[model samples]
Target chain A: MPEGSMGISNIATCTAPVNIAVIKYWGKRNEELILPINSSLSVTLHQDQLKTTTTIATSRSFQEDRIWLNGKEEDINHPRLQSCLREIRRLARKRRSDGDPGLDSTGLSHKVHICSVNNFPTAAGLASSAAGFACLVHTLARVFGIEAELSAIARQGSGSACRSMYGGFVQWIMGHQDDGKDSLAQQVEPETHWPELRILVLVASAERKPIGSTSGMHTSVETSCLLKHRAEAVVPVRMDGMIEAVQRKDFPAFAELTMKDSNQFHATCLDTYPPIFYLNNVSHQIINLVHQYNNYYGETRVAYTFDAGPNAVIFTLQEHVSEFIQVVRHFFPPETNDGHDFMFPCVVLKAGPGPCVVDDPTQHLLGTDGWPKKTE
Target chain B: MPEGSMGISNIATCTAPVNIAVIKYWGKRNEELILPINSSLSVTLHQDQLKTTTTIATSRSFQEDRIWLNGKEEDINHPRLQSCLREIRRLARKRRSDGDPGLDSTGLSHKVHICSVNNFPTAAGLASSAAGFACLVHTLARVFGIEAELSAIARQGSGSACRSMYGGFVQWIMGHQDDGKDSLAQQVEPETHWPELRILVLVASAERKPIGSTSGMHTSVETSCLLKHRAEAVVPVRMDGMIEAVQRKDFPAFAELTMKDSNQFHATCLDTYPPIFYLNNVSHQIINLVHQYNNYYGETRVAYTFDAGPNAVIFTLQEHVSEFIQVVRHFFPPETNDGHDFMFPCVVLKAGPGPCVVDDPTQHLLGTDGWPKKTE
Candidate 1:
């Protein structure tokens, strides 16, 4: 530690909402740059129900940078972690050199210790990486007093994390630049754009780590010709259609496109050599139930989309939420023997804002000593 | 009833082997003609293990065309059935017009009674339609005494049935003709070509009827853009690769391609709107086992392919059959409580010949009266 900056510490806490891709991001053109093969769209869920709370503490007394994810210290040397840290520091240096008065010079050179936790169970098949990275970058920015476009930095952490930087509708444009400078997430609409639109996360009973999106998508790019065609021909059109539907608040159109795109993403997964099976029996039954339920109403009342795992993220109007939940419970009866009220727990949320700074001191996950506070 | 030929009944019986596609047939361009969107290749299982036997009886005394499948009467008015019968009769008339004196004129005008039965359990998930249609067409040709390119007739019965027209390895050529006159199945290699290749039908425990190929493929064609790209860009190269592998008797190359194509077919199934779920937990576990087993051996010792259901049709060289079967039995233990030796009954078979006429009188499924004999 530098003697002049001894015992100096700065802390920032923030929470980022989880974003469910409506037009899925599957293949990548540039692995290192995290440049996607096709543009993707997502709806950011309300943070109160589903989010990652990340607290970053920077101290001149700290010997090195570190991170604790959900109470366990993970490898701080992970390549993606380094990428995110490097990009953020680089942006902070540029702002300081450009005579930005608000830039914290001491915190810029200080080592950071990040503590992150999710509100929902990590085993529920919900993707935490997006929210985790988004919250990390957002909190790090606040501590360093650097606030420009941070989504590009989050993109360096995880491809889908870029979309989580914005609330409501967001699109990750697949830029043509070799350097990936133009490839960044842009907001299509704000949180209040569609008030009646609701999102439900159906936590599937089976909890297994799916084939990591990085490796799974890498194989798809290499082996699946169908994926190549899909990236080139199919997704571009769907991205446009989805944006239009969200803009018009056309529930039926948005719901249909969301389901189709999710199905196609999983299709590409299966098309990969040796194939990948993510959705299980419960997932399939849920798909059938949703379609049957929609058919009974003679219109598309509900739509289901699955990510890399079996848990389904459903999109429907506010009016249909109760009925859809009832249908899900009836079909997948809760196991009373296990003392659970639901076979798959349902988390209901609506579109909400992106990462925001936490002002309350009690919510701080890190102590003044630049380490995660012990939980009782 | 026609009094002129009331007492005359010409009966012919034939058996056809069940063919499992390595390169799957999933869509059609011409539904009426049964012209496939993509060419497909299949290995015919040995008749001794899995096959369909059909008896065709032509009698002027019969009031109308009738059919029985597995002892139960089925509507003969089915369009595909009508297409097969009409094509055979049309071909018979053409042969007679060409001054072929041996054509059976009385049998051509007679109303036909068709009876078909599968040797393997229908609940085993083995495709019976391909074999059933092939046997029906082959037996019909014998009774009518017309035998020039009968595969085109079989193709009308089922898109995959055309591949069952020839032995060993067969390819259904997806012709460019709108009329489908040139669409025909060609033999890639006879049953004698690959002597050491073996097949095992893993009869998965779950035995629900799958989405019929006709309806399934129809939806895929309509809804899945990935299916479109696959037919256009993927299968052509795979077909060539598969044919070369079969010719070289290359087990590794053949196995890899077989697994890839099957995965792609199911991938297209998932891409279908209201997405179809063919592979269940058992199917997924079997897939993982096959991959793990091959990985353990450090070579492609076995390969698996699934059609429209959970049952896995595995392919391997003769040297690996016993060990692989042991692996399968160990992983999927037989149901001792149900008195079944194998939970998934394994029927070992080798590549076999096409449909053949049953010359023995006692083998006829229909009695001398031109009616299906009652099952005792």
Candidate 2:
């Protein structure tokens, strides 16, 4: 039999959503495995704003494994991607030995071809890796017929990336003792817990990122004492504050900590050796306007926060979302020459249930009739 | 007397720097007197960024007290301004009775005419009121030859106004007892103490304020449990952190606290019943970029903050200033186009010392002949 002809008979595929860290994941204690020093949290925005959709297929007919991103085939040799694939295969091997009925019935074989696409910018502080890893893990799990928890396998891909595996409010518990044995993501409060909350994302400007989180976190760990204090002293208080605020549906408390935590996180970033520039002039103006407008209205109405880009993620009650939209429109009036470009591109999404299988996993790897069939 | 022929017989002038609060002051217990609920601290930037230069003169020829701000004469009947003037006068009366030789011997008459100009935006978040009222009180003291502490009197004009009276690090004591008599601005440290520090300000965007600070504070007082918690819980920790950061020359700590305080202050603004929007996208971007860049570099190199306007003010050690400037310039590249002319309007300035006596008060106001004369 020809080498390329073996591709179609063996493999399977799947897709998953990308996640962005609200409480960022900065440092990695173990680089090869991509493990983090502490737990992080993030909001998985709706797929419309940003997401990753990937499909993985395996066949006994295939000669070598292959991959494509955004329709263009990328080098699978990239170390980060390689590590992820290798880890998932190792996990699948363990599941295969369990002798489970589910694993035995898939009639699967092992030459894989994976293709992924990101709806947003790649490696530009948008946490593209989070979605990439989640999808990779999910695809491999489905292919091998491994029924174990998806998050456990995802954690092997990237520490922060694991949290992205689940939806709604998820927490990455950095288990005590450095072997990283028990570290995994757990869903804390579901999306439906707070239905009235709305997020206003202001994409101030999307310019090329000056630096990547990998190198940045390396420098921060080596140089910043402030980082130590923040990770140890401040984060604990903030986490407590966050949990209480979320539980009570206390907008005032939540807004206060959200803004404070965002700034403190960035402050730690600045405390890093050479410094960082996240928020720009337009970003600053939005923060100020929200502050003064809120003060004018005299109540806890809106909370605005910023992540790694010149984008603002503001949370306000559903009742005042229209007001937020109106005020933002008025302040950042439409530009002439330029079509309807918003200084703050507001994304209003109600959180969804945790990640679930989007496609049926019971179908055969090849056509049921056993003819040379379609390719994904 | 012919109105055209009327001229001032005596004039006294003074200048005050605009103070930007490091730990902001908001929510006054006594609105009439502008007594703040908590002690505040600020850095008096160079007069080049923001300051109020005022000229005060009096003559029997003038029928009533009158005032002009930024070239336009304002209605003296406006209660805020009126109260400011009357309060200063009452304090001046006490100074005159104390047998102050400067007041008793100066050749000056009644019916004062004052003119003031704010180098920065009048009502924007740059704290123009702080400089405006501080300049007013300082000039009033000079004219009345009042020996009383300028800060104590400045407080009556605007609570945070007191901090503007001095140069460098200043603290506005919230005072323990209910009478609020002891609540006043006091010098924490002086500017010369940390001359190596550099401030890079990014003017995000400007807006005509929807509500002034006075009204904003009033509304915050009426609502916002977050405001109460901040006054009791957050501010104290920040105040301590700031003072220590400044005293120890700990840039990492200082940067963190400064950034944290700014975000927290704005958060409180959001927590206000109706909510206020003080910052814009530019402001938020500045913050995000700072985080990304700093996280990339790893160590304390720069710190960013925002006032009530959509502007970003960043502080860093003198050494990194050039790099920051270059980065900022690169990000906001200059471009020009027009049908008939080229315009590059936004100019960046490195601030200098705050408002001070340029023409000697005795030489110009008292005149060489020992008689005050109107220059105009």
Candidate 3:
């Protein structure tokens, strides 16, 4: 047990990687339960390049549970946040009740203070929520001394967050049960399975905030008949195909399916009653450039996928990375005629391991006062 | 009979209105026959505001068949052009063989000189093909002295052009016949059915030529699985609902379905492999403004649709036309801060009649030389 000035507290620090979906999860069957309409697959990106660092501290004398995201305090009463917190506590209590000897019985009733920050700028529009929730669940599990499966708890925060539970290739099985107990993230393969695979994120300069995936998908489910058909017919085959592509280390097959799935997802967005526009001119240009580059080589050497924003995540092999990057730079020159930097910012990353626990004392986000430490 | 410099010729001048698809015709099941994968519905705009005036002459002494579009001579050897010309001749031959006494047998094997022009600027990005092909087929029928269902012939020129063969609310039935002989356009209601309905073409200033519908739909059919689902499952039901909406003159229901179908069409475009982008920032802004205006009024007053371009074709009742147009002008200010005329040009029109011949001799495109006269 750790002692704060006011009372006894347990603290844990952990970090999670951002996962980019190839076969995307669009609509939720159960909004409250966060159960998706179809199975989804993703590639967990390297934590060193992009990650969320979360510090969780549970104290006996704390006033209440609170959370500060990226140096700014947020509403702790947000329903999704409550869902994650409640699920994690329930799991901890279940472990104790099941006669798990390793359970820390003291922290079960304690209030928690969470400090979460991303290494990358949140404004960059790289999916921070997946990493945020995954880190929250991982750190909370460590603080409570509960080590059982926690992907379901992470999913209660965000539908896509469940895929971030494991590194390398992961799949979220859309189970049929109403209770959603079987709908959990499973690792298809380890990080070392595909050493040559590379991911490059082209961060577009977004002018306005796009519609949230939650509300956008809600509209799709309610109004888009195309979406319903895709969920029922198209995705099951795609889920199987993507899993096979990952297992076989088939780069071209994987790339083609990624791009197609991304296109179909945006298609569903357009099919929504009011329609949604996610990709902008830059994103369009990037897509064209990728295809043109691949066509020039007489084969598909690169693939691009977009989420709910203009940014594009490209999948390619290590051998083609340098040439592809050069091609991108050539078309969208970094320096404009007036010497201003006008190019889209890009981050190159590779497949990496899952969430990690930080054992170093100096890296702790919470101080002895059971509160976040002041930083310069 | 009219006498050219070399020989006698039969000449006919006609004009056809541009029909905007509320329910779009996208993919084709039989490319050669121009048979669509799904049924489509459209509203024909008044020819007085926007139309293609085409003059065709069949002369015995003409050297070869030729066509001039908007003052520029184009190759008559284009396959679609050949398809139209062959189909018209075949129909005329069939009529003659059947001993139709009204047929002009003398002009059966004569060569044709075609000159077509639009009342509005061709660069405005409004769909010219629908009206252009419809007028061509209609005029050719008159010049050849054959009076039969010519929508089938026009369909061989372009799929959507078949729908333009009729006025007011028309539907191109995606018939199941393998030979495409039964695939034809039918009028759901005459132009006078909906007196208060109006169409406004918000011609967006296109910076570059968009992908032609021919190649665009080709790519969509080959790549987009969502399109497959839409054509198979979604569109059939939409066609029924839209026809009912139009028959009942239910403005709100009609508006909702029109907007949704248009969105789904563009969504299919996005679902294309390389992903075609027809809507731009200006198009997006207009969509937002329309929705925001409708939400403010607590009713659907206006609905919008787009073809293979950024221009928005709005469907609204005559009572709300002025207000909607005012709302449009307010959101997209005509004058920019720099005093440049950046306003999106608009053309207001209503449902009108089908192609009609001009009996006035001065309206003929070709002069005595059996060729198009030079225009200043």
Candidate 4:
């Protein structure tokens, strides 16, 4: 996607955790700069269960910059990909010009080879782009020795990608500027702040969404009056309450706000002129089950938030996780009791670290020859 | 329920057509008085295909006030029912006190018996309450020999019932009055104004809705900010556009406004706390089919609106009805081709008269004995 490091002898591999927005980021104000209409908060899930590993290798012998996604080589010139590459290299040059001593010695502008793959299914409507871009930017920074304020660059790749640059509870502030320079993600709390907080990603359907968020949001901004009102009046207050709930570890408050924000997001979708329906029958069934389960407990024990798809990302406390999983199983029975289709078919995760370099050479996605390696 | 016409010897029978709101009524400013928070407009469907017939009889030997709905006796003292009964009697008494010569001949005060039934299924969620209450109030008015303004009395029965009291396109103005005397339904245009407009009631599900409109609107008024905004800002402008569209006989303009208003109503439902979902998978599929069919024609040939349940009410020009019905059948095949459950299980309706006296003695719901008779 971009010219590789000046002269790096070693490949850089980094893993980025997927972040699920509780306060969803839907419409964008500035399409080109990827600025959101409202501030959103999200939790970065543990990389151990779900993550994207991206390895970038630079070589003087390489003919051109190339990229491989999920073991398949794809166009390196996709507009958003190009934006990420341009921003990262511009920052590297700035660092070198400022005599930061981060540039390598060879002074050779080499072609780049990037290989990225996710441990989970990309078709599950998860925020894979967020993790992909976050990992790419994080790896590029490591290669170029450029460290400060990288989230702004990641925002160019994908709007929500900026949030995955930080772990645990992060807020992407909707700044009031034409250039969107101030709309960057800030960490509200680290992964360890709420150990009791747990996440379950229930995959309702593995099919890709019919309409992408980019196009769906474009129509919403143009047609949906509710979305405009929400951006102007509703979200400002919700963002503050969400941050406070995270800071205080108030489970009930956080759960209620999260669920309400999610419903409001989908409501705006329905309010669109022709209307957009992202949640299907299974999604509705899961929503009903969650509400019934909470009502049975006489409290808000668990909350579910969906992001532009049928899959549900659940938020619950550690104490309720086991029982809740059992309850979910009781309602939505798996097709098979065998190990393959069993276990409720969801990943139990927690808040975890953001993108970081992998120190082990054996885990590198590229060979020492600066080429893509074939995995078993 | 009201002591029937100062004891008229003859039973009065009246039929009222169902009204489907293009501009929905979802909240209340005064619950007891049934004053809506926003003005709404609806089309009264033709009575031949779908209507409610009510008969009222007064006799000196009759017992306390009683009522029968769909061949089953129901509580006569239901608060809303009582409100209608009390309001009508108060108006009749005032008329008598003013020396009105048009009052009935019989001066003997007697108890009343009322019987009501629908030509269509009551559980279809087809605004049966609107038709039922309109028929009730209209029958009572004929029995009492009072006819100055009866829509306000019908409003006390059910909010939408006010619209059904007038023929063709009616607009119920959300008047600002503590007593709700000014909140009344007025005819925007008679049924003969437009002969090309057609409607189809697509029966998605006949099952009773889990939450009734009365209670659902209560929750929405209390919890949904979008509902308040729609009432205060959105619906007023929408009401004007809808009335103009109906007057101009602009099918596209009318269809678009109808679809948009219905979407906004359902959007507010989803924005409620814990949220309310009225459209099921079939409803969504029908919506998609309409959009796709319209897109295929490169024009708005058809439009759909859903109320508090899954059934879809379609609006199209007379020229497009047959083609659109064919498209709907192609998408959603009927389970049977027999006379029963066949024909797509829908009634093709057109704008028609409001409530009127059914003069034929043999057509009366109540027998000559002044009690409910067994029907074949």
Expressed as tens digits, the lDDT of each residue in B1-376 for candidate 4 is: 3354343375799999999999999999889999999999999999988999999987766768899999999999899999988888887788888888877645236677999999888857789999999999999888877877999999999999999999999999999989999999999999999999998998877788878899999999998888888899889889999999999998999999999999999999989887889897677878888888899989998999989988889999899888888888887777743222233637788999999898887887777667887882
lDDT (0 to 1) per candidate:
0.86, 0.66, 0.87, 0.86
For every prediction, compared with the true complex, DockQ reads 0.60, 0.09, 0.62, 0.51
Alpha carbon deviation, residue B351, candidate 3 (Å): 1.1
Error of 2 at A243 (Å): 9.9
List, residue by residue over B294-332, the lDDT tens digit for candidate 3. 999999999988888888888888998888888777777
* Backbone clashes, candidate 2: 96
Model 3 chain B poorest ten-residue lDDT run: B336-345
Question: What RMSD does model 1 have?
Answer: 2.9
lDDT of 2 by residue, B1-376 (tens): 1123355555666777877677878889887767787778888877764567777776666678877787677887876677767767777776667666656533234777777876677654577877888888777666666657767777777787888888888889888756667888888778877878777666555566566777887877786555666677668877888888888878889887777677766655654644555654446556776766667679768887777666677888888777876776655555522211121213333324444665665434333332333463
Candidate 4 residue A11 Cα shift, in angstroms, is: 2.7
The C-alpha stretches of model 2 lying farther than 4 A from their native spots are A1-10, A18-67, A71-113, A117-128, A158-376, B1-11, B19-66, B70-127, B167-183, B187-306, B310-376
2 versus 4: better TM-score goes to: 4
- Candidate 1 similarity to native, TM-score: 0.95
> What CA root-mean-square deviation does each model show from the true structure?
2.9, 8.0, 2.4, 3.4
* Stretches of model 1 off by over 4 angstroms after superposition: A1-5, A101-104, A336-342, B1-6, B102-104, B335-342, B374-376
Against the true structure, what is model 4's DockQ?
0.51
